[model samples]
Target: MQAEQAGALTVSDKPTTPMQMIAHAVANGAPVETMEKLLALQERWEAGEARKAFVAAMSAFKAKPPEIFRNRAVSHDRGKSTVFTHATLDNVCDALNVALASHGLSFRWETEQLEQGIIRVTCILTHAAGHSERTALQSTPDTSGSKNHVQAVGSTVTYLQRYTLLAATGIAVQGQDDDGAQGQKDQPITPEQVASLQAGLDETGADIQGFCKYMRVGALAEITMSGFGRAVAAIDAKRKKAGSA
Candidate 1:
């Protein structure tokens, strides 16, 4: 009768989970080795399920991505006192936090000094299910505009943190490039322009991350219409130099 009951417990209309299997084994007085195997199997199953949940939440977040805009402006002292606008870290968090939380997701940043003057910032996006994804960006300190050593490091860390979050989420700021002086028409480059630049980069063996940093944008697509010509020229120069070599 006990054996029959055990068999019945193991049989179910729905698929039996690893945990259920472990319970059935325990009730049947299974060996210690069997219990250990079942526990390992259960752990694997849970991890796989958590990963699936993470992917689903990310998809939902992207479907209705948050719209972020440039909220802070910086003015340079040289070259006609150029000014540019960028979405601050606070702006990015305010725009994304609610949406991300609603989908059971959250993010945090980690910083490391890779070498002298080079800082690497990593953005970690975690789901409620215990799965996480990370994106990292590295850059030197921003010593421009009379910043001290501390301020320069802080500036670079903030910049890398903001960009790493954006990169990890696969989102970009909407409306206007970083250059506020371009007025209202400072739109992002067209898809064709993006493709052209990508091709040039590929041909020249250029590092896309370095290129984005040099262009003062988070991604290639975020390059401004006004800056498109300059980007292309830079790429052309690289291509020519590579050909000569």
Candidate 2:
């Protein structure tokens, strides 16, 4: 359900949860009914305001870049002490140029109207889809130690930087990492576990049907590896019967 710069990634490193899926839906401009269904499935949002903010962040994330930037060039010489290299914003600008031709969506920057002392560049993905008028979304500005992202779905939409994988993928995949000092994931599943799971299934005749259920990360222990074991046990009898047949 995610696409990187331009590669097919199995994405075993990160597994998205129902809550994260719901959040992605909201971010991608899902309908009210869809949001309600999502809200019911995941109780991550307790307060109404928190729910609203979550939805808002998601909606903006699905937008594609609608601005053109400068180009960059690099030159290196073995004899030179300092290498001459310059990076340009050209790629961003080229993306913006292409995004303008999409449907009736008019892409524009809204930084001048900012009263918050921060620039907010908006790409109006408008008049398309179910929207009657244009939807104006501000791209999170690039600032030191600050982060911003935008993505909208049904198109090559957006979100994040180093955390792009998280935003592009889902928050659940990045939750533990974000909580840590360094942005590194802490999922503990291993090849041995999968092998163990297979052996455990064969030995105790544990249900293999529900095994895919455990092939994911959980926010807590009850929903973690141990919980997966319980799930296998719960379906053991059924799988044993099926296997014998």
Candidate 3:
């Protein structure tokens, strides 16, 4: 019977999944038609399972949002200017791991070296059911510090990894303090603010890396409301200087 032949076409319970069984059967030279059916069933099963896992993971993530702290401060303009407070890569990951784990999820990153000094970092957030989401970001070497070539590349890679992971999870650093004002720090920048910042960058023709350094923030999107004015003003100053030069 076709049913009996179909069951016989698959591998035993050790491999478990239909796909794995199909692979095992292929290695032993199973019939093409049988393999095709197994592959089709595997595809359907995987799609359904992935959808379920994604929904469950999202629910878990929303249940308890992460609370992160600003653990590092970057001094800009020779310390005569503003200090930007931010969460370090370690602090961000530390805050996220437990929360992600509780939701049966984990994340890993892959790095690629593109042409020139560009490095691409991809964060893969996976659920226990073998479903995953990925976020990729690229940045050039951090040429600001006294870092040699290797350090510059490594620093940029680390920075991109941290941000890509957070971007994928939609997790922003949350500052906490006894003062009530610190709670307001978790508020994300609005779309209007982002548009204004982009306009400033366009006017100055500023590179994103340079703009971030000028503002003393890790990324343009991370710029706070208070920082937005300073960013625009700095860009305007640069624009004026360029115009006069």
Per TM-score, the best of the predicted structures is 1
lDDT of 1 at 38: 95
Candidate 1 Cα misplacement greater than 4 A, ranges:
1-10, 13-15, 179-245
The model with the greater lDDT, 1 or 3, is 1
Give all TM-scores, in the order shown: 0.68, 0.20, 0.58
Better of 2 and 3 by lDDT: 3
Ordered list by TM-score, greatest first: 1, 3, 2
lDDT per model, in order? 0.81, 0.36, 0.73
Per-residue lDDT of 53-161 in model 2, one digit per residue for the tens?
A: 4445445443543322223333333354322222222343345334433433323332222222212222323223222211222211333122333212111123112
Each model's Cα RMSD? 9.6, 23.5, 12.1
- Clash count, candidate 1: 0
TM for candidate 3 is 0.58
Give the Cα error of residue 75 in candidate 2, in Å.
11
